[model samples]
Every structure is written in structure tokens, then in C-alpha cells.
Target: MPEPVVVDAMGGDHGPAETVGGAVLARREHGVPVVLVGRAGEIRAELARHGAVDEIDVVHAEEAVPMGERGTGGAASGASSLRVGCELLRQGAGSALVSAGSTGAVVSCAIRGVGRAPAVLRPALAIALPAVTGGATVLIDAGATSDPTPEMVAQFALLGASYARLVLGAADPSVGLLSIGAEPGKGNRLTRRVAELLPLLPLRFHGNVEGHDVLAGAVDVIVTDGFTGNVVLKNVEGAVRAVLTLVARSGTAAPEALREVARRYGPETHGGAVLLGLSGTVVVAHGSSRAATVARACAVAHDLAGGGVAARLRDHLTAEPVN
Candidate 1:
């Protein structure tokens, strides 16, 4: 009964197979309305395989943005599934967009098509990663702006803090700058400069946090450039897998218990990283995502869109500005 979430069916590693199946799953299992945007024939065939051809709507697209594309090409092409899906969101034909396409391309297309919220210098990808304290740490610029200005990084902290408050329900969330050392004036020139600017802004700056503290729950929000944040995200996933595998082999924990822990941190459970500071909701999932991950991505988009998260986030940032 709600507006359908648009999915770029040809964007992921498994293409229409996983994406379309995910759309069907979101509609049938989660009761979320979905619209698949991709090649009409392939989408229908995949939907038919799930016996959902009649349930979900399909919008034909002539192209798909390649995984390597960095937004310009994806945004220029009117027929790419990424572009088409973004247009649907921009035009109000869809409530939100869920894509496993290149994060750069999705961010690029969303900005060009759906636009950014007023006064947003650059949009960011914020991911809520589980912490050891049972609360989540919101990592901003988690792959959206690999290289951003000092001011942009400062704003990322603002966005990350606001997200912690609105979504994670953290009151007065403490913010940390990701650095090599916990001391001030640590990390590269970018981080060093950011450290100097953080205290000047309206935030509960918690100084610097080292790599080991990312999951230590020392801070509610962690702000860094997209490149390092992406590396951190991948490293966390790999470490989780490796440690759990070793634990299973050691027989210290039950296999079922280990499986549950893995599932808790899996891509399917979290869906994907959200592109924040935009005018509309856009969720970018793993390029290698399968049906379950895609379905969860759609559900995430639905909830964020319905909750008026983008508007609320903009207001929050305005109330407590970075600059």
C-alpha cells in the first residue's frame, strides 16, 4: 500500500538473478512494495521463476552501470538501470532506491537525478556497524567521497552524530575522529586538520580513536574519509569471518553459536550502507550481494523513507551545524 522501493535489477554481481529474487522476497516476505528497474525480459523471467511476475512492477532499462563506473558515466546514461531507478525516486514514482551498483555510480546518479539536500557540500555513505558494547557505531563517509575537504570531513562528523541520535536513539552521541593514534595531531594531514576543526564545531568531540577502538564502543560516531572507512569496513568483515572460523575449528564455541554471530554481522542482515546527506533515500549494497541482502536493502530503504529520515537529518544538522 506504500510507495514501491525501486531496485536496480542489473546492478549487482549476480545481476537480475539475485536482484529480482530479492525484490520478490521483499514484497512477499517483508510486505514491502517493490519495483524492479532493468531489462524487461530478463526481469520478468526471473520474477516468473519466483512466481511473482504478477506481483511486482517492472520498469524497462536499456543499460546497467558497470561496477567500475565512478558516477559520471552512470549519471549521463539515461537508460542505465541506476539512472532509471534514481529518476523514479526523483520523480516520486518510488519511495526510495536500493542498488548494489558501484557506490560511486549510485552516489553520482542520486546526486544528479534525485539531487542533494540544501547546503550539502557532498553526500556521504554512513553505515551503522555493531560495537562490542551492544550499541552501534555510525561510520560516516564509509565509501562516498574517497577524497574530501577538511570542511567536508567536519560535516561528515555532524551527519554521523545526527544519524546516531535519530536512528540509533543515542542521546548526545560522542564523536571520534579515526586516526592512527588516540592522541591529538595524529594521522595524516587531512585527519590532523580535521582534529583542529572538530572542537570548534557544535559536537561532543571525543578526541581521536585508533583502529583498535572502532568496535570498542568508545565513541558513538566515527568520521573519516571514504577510502579509509571502506578499508576498515572490509577489514572488520574479514576479521569477523576469520576469528569465527578459528573459533569453530577450536570447538570453543558451538557451531550454531558461531553461525549466529556470523549472521549478525553478515551483509544480508544489515542490507547495505546508506548514502546520507541527499534529498532522497538511496541504499548501496555489496556488489556481490545475493537475494537476501538485496531484499533487506529494500526493506531498509522502505523504513528510512517512511520515517522521513532525510528531512529529519537535514533539520538535525541545521540545528547543530558544522560550520
Candidate 2:
């Protein structure tokens, strides 16, 4: 069994209810311990509601950091639930940390509190997105850096490749540079440069792949700048939602069957994303996550923790450099 995962119970939009409920569900179903970090009273109350008050543990933090709250310089004060959650990972008291806080704040506090793995300059977020192949593909820098350099994209490819190998268990995870077209020279200078550089990496680089390639399962890993990656992710999510809606109204199936169809398109279907390139496990859940989604995030965190993802990533990175 892995160590407990620290949940930032106050970070998401729904606060203690959904966050704490998720923790309870994770502990009950997955048997992973959860340290709920937030206002102690509210967390305790939520836990009691789930009849898990005695089963789980609560760590008290004086304040709750809301979504959109800036890190270090905003109206919010210093020392947040995210900070405490990261500290749990740093101290080895927790195997990983899950939060739905501001992405920027989580990234900032994670870098400052947990620190980066050796040779990892910036931490990247890697997500497993549903594809047309009936499986998921890894898209890195989903929302981490806004303007990542080609070298950074290369680094993302490396990390993403490792994730596909270890987490997804791919033999030779084919890496793709997310571009406008499949041609080597297509896309912006950064994409072309990254496409040119990725093959020299230790992992198997599949050359340039386009957006449709993301779902086509043409490649296992897709690497791009956070700005472009975020945009593509949002658009894909919207498209999935629309498809699910149509499926529900299609009259070809019962509501329960339609729900299964919707489940296939759910954003939470892949759980939370791991913040790669960091020294420890850090999972970030969607802000609107329900209990099951949060529980799934916890299970993913447990997988990374038990697998030693961060250490393997560090070793992989130290062995290579941007070409």
C-alpha cells in the first residue's frame, strides 16, 4: 500500500463538500489514506456526513485559498492549503497532493514548497485524454507554461514519453510534436524546431503529428506549448461534451446506457493530471470535479506514488538534454 494522499479540501469551487467527499470515497473504495487539508471544522463535518469521520484524518490550516486567488502577491495571505498539501508530500507524510486551486497558484506553491526534481527547471502537467482509438493519449503542458520554448517542448516530450511507458505501460511510446500539419516544416518555428529535436531523444519520437492525430491514436504522446495545448484541450473537452449531449438525446438507448456513453466522454474519465518534472507526485483535479472524479484523482496519485514516477522522471531527464 502507498502512503496517504493529501487533498486540498478547500481549493476547488465546491470547497469541502465535493473535495472532502472525494477523499472519503477514495479511502473507502481505493483504500488509500487521505489527509484532508483545510479548515478543520468544515472538513470534519463533511467527513462525518460521509460516515468517514473516524476513518480519515484532518490537517488544519488557518485559511482556505479560493480559486482565482493569486500566489504570494494577491489579496490572499501567505501559507495556503496548497502550501500545506505540498509540505505533506515534501515531508514524506503524504505520497502525493491533489488540488483544484488556481493552476498558477498550485504550480507556484508546488515549485516553492515541494521543489523540483534535480535538473528539472520547470514542472509540466501531463493528462491522459480520450482519443478516437478507444484509449487515451498524453498531452503535456496542458496549462503550465504559457510560452514554453522548443527546448521545453522537447523536455515535455521526454517526460510525456516516460509517463506513457511507466503509467500507461506502452513499450515504445511514440512521441509526436503537436503541429498544424503532419509535415516536418509545418506549424510555427517552435513546433518545427521541437519536431526536429525530439527524435534525438532517448524515447521513440514519431515525427510531426497534427491535432486530429491527438484522437486518431497515431501517437501516444503529444507535446506542445501550454498556450496551444490549453486551447486544444478546452476545445476537445467542449467537443466531447457536445457529443455526449447528442448521445443522451439520440433515443437509441436508455438513460442508463446514455450515462455510460456520457461516462466515456467525461473529462474526469482519465482522472487528474500528474505535474511532471517535479520531485514528487502532484495531481491536479478539475475544479468542478465530483466525488468520483476526486476519488479517481486520488487513485492516480497513489499509482504515481507507488511507481516512483517523479524519481524515474528525474533519472530520465538527467540522462538527456535539449538538442
Candidate 3:
């Protein structure tokens, strides 16, 4: 049997409850192995609530990291469940780690515990969004590093391309630098420099793609700094929700059609973003995730770890010589 996926059971808004419930769902419905790390008593109580006591393993953790912790404070201090879960992953106690904790804390702890892959200046978060062109688009730096240098952004492009091919199965994926305009040298200084460097790398560079190009499938992989990428992600979610509401209110789309569209874009559909460029797999779900989202995250992490995403990315980066 494969090693279990480690979950920070007390890291999210409704953890121990939601996380533990999700673990039960993953085990019962998905047949995936999971180990929950947090306050053992609380986890048992929640599991008992679902009549699932002792069905999953619970690793004890004394403290919990606050959801409001964005900075380096208190995060690095002690044996928090987030850190313990990362340590479990680093020590090979689990195949992957899933957390809906603070994105910054998760990234920082994973980098410190699981470490970065070879030649990775900084780790990035990548997610595939359903596109208008039938397939999906891989968006990198979804919220991992907000102020990476130009060189780091270029590396994010490579990571995104690899993720497209490996996880999303986009054969020979083409990458685009997300920019203000769809022309060369058309973005801020960071994007301009990154645009210059991308073509020099060992991937198919698609020049610059404007905002609309993201969902148009103009390129398989879209790369940008975390700040902009995060904004784009939230904006896309809000825009989709608003558009669906308008369509339903106007009776322009059939009820089933609108339901299918909403299901495709739901957070439960994708589970979460994979923290790319790490030495191991870590899926960071939305902090406000529910049990369904948590279960999906565990399944996603198990599949990614089984596919050796982190090792494959490490080997790819090493062979490509990103310098």
C-alpha cells in the first residue's frame, strides 16, 4: 500500500472537524490513505461525531498556527500542526501534505521542511483552470511569492510548463507571460525582463498574453508574479459567479447547463493549488474549505505524489539548466 497523505488537521477555519471529516470521506469514498496531524483528542471527538473513530490515524500536535499569520511571526516558533505535518512529509511518514492554512505559512514551512527542488529560486503555486477551448490553462505563482525577481518569474514559467505536461497532460505545452498587452516589451519591468529570458529557456514561449488570453487558451501555461496571479484567480472566480447569476436571472441558459458550468468552476472540483518547485508534494486548499473540498484535496495530493510530480520537476529543472 502507498504511504498515507499527511493533513494539517487543525490548520484551517474549521479544521479537526472539516479536516477529519474529509479524511474519513477520502478513506471511505476514495480509498485513499490519510494521517491527520493535530490535537489528538479534538480529532477523535470530531471523528466520533461522524462514527469514524480510529478509522484514520491521528498524529498529536500541541499548537495550531493562526489563520491570520501572514508574516514570519509565530509561524517559525514551535511544534504547530502545520510544521508537524510538514515534518512528517520530510521524514517520509507521508507521501504528500495537504493544508488549508495560511498560504505564506504553508509555503514557508514546506520549503524549510521538505526543502526546494534543485535550481528552484523560489517555489510557486500552480492551478489549472477550465478554459473556453475545451481543455485547461496552467497558471503559476498563484500566490506563493508576491515579489519575486524577474529571474524567479522566468523560472515560474518553466515550472508551470512542466506542471501542464505532467499533471494536466498538456503535451508540448506552450507558455505565455501574462502581461498588460499582447506584444513584446509591453509589460512592467519585471515582465519585460522575463519575456526576454523565457525564449532563451528550453520551452515554447508564446510572447505576451493579455488578460483575456488567460481563459481563451492562447497558451497552455501562463506565468506571472504571485500578486497578479492571485488577483487574476479571485477575479476569475468572482466573474464566473456573477456571469452565471446574470445568465440564470435572465433565463438565458437552461438550469442543467448553468449547474454543470457552476460545478466545473467550483473549488471542490479542483481541490486546491499545488505548491510547485518543492522537494515534495503539497496541495494548499482554500482556507475556508469545507469537508468536500478537503476530501478532494487529499485525493489530488495522493495522485500527484503517486505520479512523482516533485521529483519529475526536479529532474526537468536540473536537465534544462535554468541559469
Candidate 4:
């Protein structure tokens, strides 16, 4: 039997009600079992409201982490829902963890509680975006480590490639370094140094890729430092939302083609980003996630856990030294 996914039921914008409702939906629609970790009384109340009290289990967590507390020293303390959820994963109570909590808290607790995979210097947050040609393109280091070494960028390429194969089902995933220009020496010192290191790794190196190539799916995976990646991701998301809003306000009803395009570009439909390089599968959902987004996040966690993503990553990383 597959292990259950541990959900931080009290950690999203909507709290327990929406989180529990999403867990129920995941079980009903995707057949994925989840154990909700939060104040037992509140979680049970929400489950009872949906008449799904018997469908899932609830674990007690005394506190909840506030969104503002992230990135601070206290983010992972306080017996918070995310902290307890990570503890459960460490103890084998669950195979993976899905949280819409503070990304810093989740990342911190995961590293401290579950530890990092062997040979992995840092974990990366990977977001999959819709590709123009057909499949999806993965952007790594979305917001995990803001300042990364050139070697870390090289590791991100490997981690992203493994993800593309296991999750995106790409055969021989091609990797591209996000830079100012497509030329080998166009980026800053980091990109130039990483460019020289990428070909030496066990991946299909496609040289440098400009910003436009991201949506064009010029490569299966685009690797960059966390700061730049986060800025690019937010910009793309904001642009997509603005365009969709304009289409809605236009006199004509949104056509099916336009709606499909919106759906394809939206982040809510894709659940959220996954934190790679950890010993366990950890999914970080959007902070403003509602029930549908939570359900998709749960499904993503279950699928990645069942696919043994952590194990694959460990093997791939250990196979060759990063230095």
C-alpha cells in the first residue's frame, strides 16, 4: 500500500476548512489517502462538515506558523503545523508532505527534520510551466536558495533533469542555463562558470537559453539561481493573470480557445512547486491556495512519492560528484 501524504491542514490562506475539504476531494477524485496535521478538533470539525470524518485521519499540532514568520530563526519552531507535518514524514508516518504554509518554514523544517539527500548541497524549488510545443518546462531554484554557487546551479540542472524524467516523463531531458543571451559567455560570472560545468554532467546540455525560450519550451528544464528564477516566475504569473483579466473584461465572452490558454498558463491548475534534493517529497503550494489548489497539491505529492522521486534523486546525485 502507498504511504499517506501528510497535509498541513491549518497552514494555508483559508486554514483548516479549505485544506480538509481539499484532502477529501483528493481522496474521492484521485484515490490518494492523506493524514491532516493540525489542531485535531478544528480539523475534525471541518471534516465533519463535509461528512468525511471517517475518510481521513487527523494528527494534532498545537500551533500554526504565520506567513510573516518565514525566513526567520523561529519559522520552524512552535510545534507549528508544518513542523509537525515534517516530523511525521521523518518518522515514516507519511511518504510526503504538502503545505501551503510559508515556503521558508517548510524548507527549513524539511531540511532540519528529514535532512538532505547525500551529496546534495542544497534543495531547489521546481515549478513546471506549460510549453508552447506540447509538454511542460521546469524552472528550478524558484525561491529556495536566493544566493547559490556555480556548483549549485550545476546540481540544479541534475535535479531538474531527474524531475523532468520522473514527473514530466521526458526522455533525455535537455537542460538550458537561464542567462542574458543565448551565447556561452553572455551571463554573469556565475552563469559563465556554470556553463563550463554543465556539459561535464550527465545531462543533455543545450547551452544558454534567453528569457523568451522559457515559454517556447526551448529546453526541457531551465536552471537558474533562486533570486532570478523567483523574479521571472512572478513576472510570468503576473503577466498571465493580467492578460486573462483583460480577456474577461472585453465585451465578448471568453472563447474556449482563450479559456484553454488561460487554464494552461495558470499556476493554480498545476498545484505548486516541489522542493527537490530532500530525503522526502515536499510540495509547497501557493500561499493563497483554496480547496481545488490544495487537492491538486495533494495529488502531486502522492504521485511524486509513489514514483520514488527522492530515491531517484539520491541515486543520480551520488552517481557522480558535484565538484
Candidate 5:
């Protein structure tokens, strides 16, 4: 059997109960083994509540890092659950890692724990969204950096393209620059410069794609600075919730029917932004994630492990010549 996926069971907004429940669900429903890292006793209690205490193993992490807290490098010093989780992967004790904690902490810990591929200066977060064009599209640097350079954006394109092909099975992914307008000269300096660099990348660079193109799935991969990516992601999420609410209040459609529509809208799609360029799979889900979301995140982790995403990305990055 393969190694289990490591989960920071005490790090999310809902704490060990939801996190542990999700791990149990992933193990039972998905046939994926998960190692819950956190306070062993609390984890056992939560597992016992779901009557799945025996189904999963607990790796004790005496310290728990709460969501929204600053990293140790800055204002405070606290034990990061993300660090412990990533260490498990580095030690070969886990296949992949999943945590619905602080995104900053997760990225920092993963970079420190597993280290980045030599070619990547900073790891990025990429997410795949179900698009209107039947298939899915990927957006990168979703809250990983407030500012990213053209070089970083170029690297994100490569990573996103590789992931699109490897995980999503897109034969040849179309890379696009996420900008304000579809016109070549419409975006800011960073985007325009990045667009200029696109021609040098290995993938097919389809020039400047607009906001609508993201939902329309006009391109396979969309690269942007983290600030813009985060805004887009949050806005889309809010829009989805608003639509669901409107549908709920309209009474024209039954709750079941509305939910079914949402389901088809790909709401059940879970898993957080995946940190690219790490030597192992590390997923950072939202802090407020529920049990089902956590379970889905674990499933995503399983997918990455099965797909050999880490090794493939490492090979792709390392293949480039040093400057």
C-alpha cells in the first residue's frame, strides 16, 4: 500500500471535529489513507464522535496553528500545523498534504519543509475551475503573492501548463495572460511585460485573455499576480453564493433542484489552491471549510499523488539550464 496523505486536522476554522470527520470520510469513501496530524486525544475524540476512531491513524502535533495568525517569521512565534504536515511528506511518511489553514503559513511552511524546485524562486498556488466551455481552466498565483514579476508569471505559466496537461489531461494546453482587456496593450506594465515573455515559454501562448475568458474557458491556463487572482476567485465565489441565494428565495425551483443545478455548477469540486514547484503535493483549503470540503481536498491530494504531479513538475523545472 502507498503512504497516507497527511492532514493538519486541527488547523482549520472548524478545528479537529470537521477536519477529522473529513479524513475519516476520505478513508472510508475514497479508499484513501490519511494521517491526521494534531493533538492525538482531541483527534481521537472527534473520530470517536463519527465512530471512525480506529479507521485512521493520528500523528501527534502538540502545537496547533490557528487560522488568520501571522507566521513565526513576522509578528509571532507559533507552531505551524502546516510545517508539521509538510515535514511528514519530506520524511516520506505521507504521500501528500492537505490543510484548510492560513494560506501564507501553508506556503511558507511547505517551501521551508519540502524546499522549492531549484528553478522556482517562489512557489505559486494554482486552482482549476469548471468553465463554460465544457472543460476546466486553471488560474495561478491565487493569493500566493501580492506582486509577481514577469519571470515568476512565466514560471507560473509553465507550471500551470504542465499541471493542465498532467492532471487535467489536456493534450496541449493553451496559455493566456489574464488581463483587463483582450487587447494586447490593455493591461498594466506587469501583465504587458509578461505577455511579451509568453512567446519564450514551452506551451502555446495565446495572447491576452480577458476576465470573461476565465469563466468561458477560452484558455487552458491563466496567469496573473496573486492580488488579481485572489480578487477574481473571491468575486466568483460570492457570485455563486448570491445566485444560490436568489434561487433559494425565488421558490420557482425546489431546494433539491437548485442544489442539483449548483452541483452541476461544480460546487462539489473541492480542494484548495495547490502550491506549485514543491517537491510534494501540498493543498491549502479555505479556513472555513467543512467536513465534505476537507474530504474533497484529500481526494484532490490523492489525485495529485496518483498523477505524480510533484515528480513531473520537478523534472520539468530542473530540466532548464541554470543562468
Candidate 6:
């Protein structure tokens, strides 16, 4: 049997009920074993309510990291659910860790607990966005390393390409530097420098791509610094929400075509971002995740772990000489 996914059951905005419910849903829908890490009593109560008390395991954690706490450097806090989840992964009790907690805390804890892959300067968060043409475009450095070095950005490209291949099944993923323009020298110094290093890697370099090209599927992977990638992700999410709201207000009830588009492209449906370059699979779900989103996240975590994402990343990175 595959190892279970460890979940920070108290990490989301909706509280333990939703988180636990999601875990149950994931087990039912995808047959993914999950170990809920949080206050045992609370988690048990929640599980009992769903009549799933015997279906999942519970590990006690006394506290949860707040959304504002940053720079913890992955220090293990016995009270923190996120820390406990990472610890479970480190101890080989679970194959992956899933948390809808503070992104910073999850990233920090995963790094400190599971450690980084060989030759990885910093880990990145990779999110797959549904593209207009078909398939998905992966955007890396979603918010992990805000001010990464040029070499770091180059590493992100390779990481993103590997992700596109493993998760999205892109035979030969095309990598593009996210910049102001499609020209080689369009972006700032960091992008320009990274652009020069991309072609030398064992990837299908597509040169520089603009922001619009992200959703247009111009490239399989779009690499950018964490700050810019985060901003772009939020903007795209907001745009999608705004359009859906406008359609609702117009009393059009959203045509089937538009509904299908929204369903495919929505962030909730994609589960959450995967933290690449870590020793184990770590999925950081949105803080506002509810039962459905949480379940989706668990499914993603299971797939990533079972698919050998970390090993593949390590092998690929180790084979390439760091610039």
C-alpha cells in the first residue's frame, strides 16, 4: 500500500470541519489514505460527525501557525500543525504533506523538516493554469522565493519543465521566461540574465514570453521570480472571478460554454500549488479552501507522491551542471 498523506487539519480558514470533511471526501473519491494532524479531540469529533472515525488516522498537534508569521526558518514548533505534518513526512510516516495554512509557514517548515534537494538553492511553488488552446501552462516561483538570483530563475525553468513533463505529461515541454515583452532583452536585468542561461539547459527554450502568453499556452512552462509570478496568479484569478460575477449580474445564468470554461480554469479545481525542490512532496492549498478544495488538494498530493515527483526532480537537477 502507498503511504498516506499527512494533512494539517486545522490550517484552513473554515476550520477543522471543512479540512476533515475534505480528507474524508478524498478517501472516498480517490482512495487516498490521509493522516490528519491536529488536535486529536477536535479532529475525532469532526470525523465522528461524518462517520469516518475509523477510516482515517489522527495525530495530535497543539497549535497552528498564523497567516502573518514569517521567517520562522522551519523551526519545529510542537504546537504547530504545519510543523507536525512536515515532521511526519520527514519521519517517513507519510508520503506527502498537505496544508491550507500560511504559505510562508508551510514553505519554511517543509524546507527545515524535509530539507532541500541536492543543488537546490531555494525551493519554488509551481501552479498549473489551464490554457486557452488546451492543456496547462505551469507557472513557477509562485511565491516561495520573491527575490531569487538569476541562476535561481534558471533553475526554476528546469524545475518547471520537469513538472510539466511529470504532472502534465508534456513530452518536450517548452520553457519561456515571463517578461514585459517577447523580445530577448525585454525584461529587467534578472530576466535578461536568466534568458541567456535557459538555452544552454536541456529544455526546449521558447525565448521570452509576455504576460498574455501565460494563459494563451504559448509555452509549457513560464518561469518568473516569486513576486511577479504571485502577482500574475492573483490578477488572473481576480479576472476570472470578475468575469463570472459580471455574467451572474447580467442574469444570463452563465451559458454552459462559459461554465465549462470556468470549471476547467478555476484555481479550486486545480487543487493547489506544489512546492518543488523539496525532499518530499508538499502541497500548499489556498487558505480559503473548503471541503471540495481540500479533497482535491489531497488527491493532488497523493498523485505527486505516487508519481515520484521528488525523485525525478532530484535526478534531473543532479544530472545538469549548475550554472
Q: What TM-score would every model get versus the actual structure?
A: 0.73, 0.78, 0.76, 0.80, 0.74, 0.78
Candidate with top TM-score is: 4
lDDT of 2 by residue, 142-219 (tens): 877778777777878877887787667898898888888877889998887887777777888888888778778778
What lDDT does the true structure give each of the candidates? 0.82, 0.77, 0.82, 0.82, 0.77, 0.81
Q: Give the per-residue lDDT of model 1 (tens digit) for 245-307.
A: 888888789888898888767742443678876656788888888999899888877877776
Error of 5 at 207 (Å): 1.9
Model 3: per-residue Cα lDDT over 107-156, one tens digit each: 77786777665567787889888889888899898888899998789888
Which of candidates 4 and 5 is the stronger one according to lDDT? 4
Alpha carbon RMSD to native, model 2: 4.5
What's the ranking of the predictions by TM-score, best on top?
A: 4, 6, 2, 3, 5, 1
Deviating ranges (above 4 Å) for candidate 1:
67-78, 129-136, 146-151, 162-172, 179-204, 227-271, 313-323
Q: Which residue pairs of candidate 1 clash?
A: none
At residue 287, give the lDDT of candidate 3.
Answer: 83
Count of clashing residue pairs in every prediction: 0, 0, 0, 0, 0, 1
For candidate 5, write residues 26-54 as lDDT tens digits: 99888888999988889899999998877
Candidate 2 backbone collisions, by pair: none
Stretches of candidate 3 off by over 4 Å are 48-55, 68-72, 102-105, 130-135, 147-151, 165-169, 188-193, 200-203, 234-271, 318-323
Clashing pairs in 3: none
Candidate 3 lDDT score relative to the true structure: 0.82
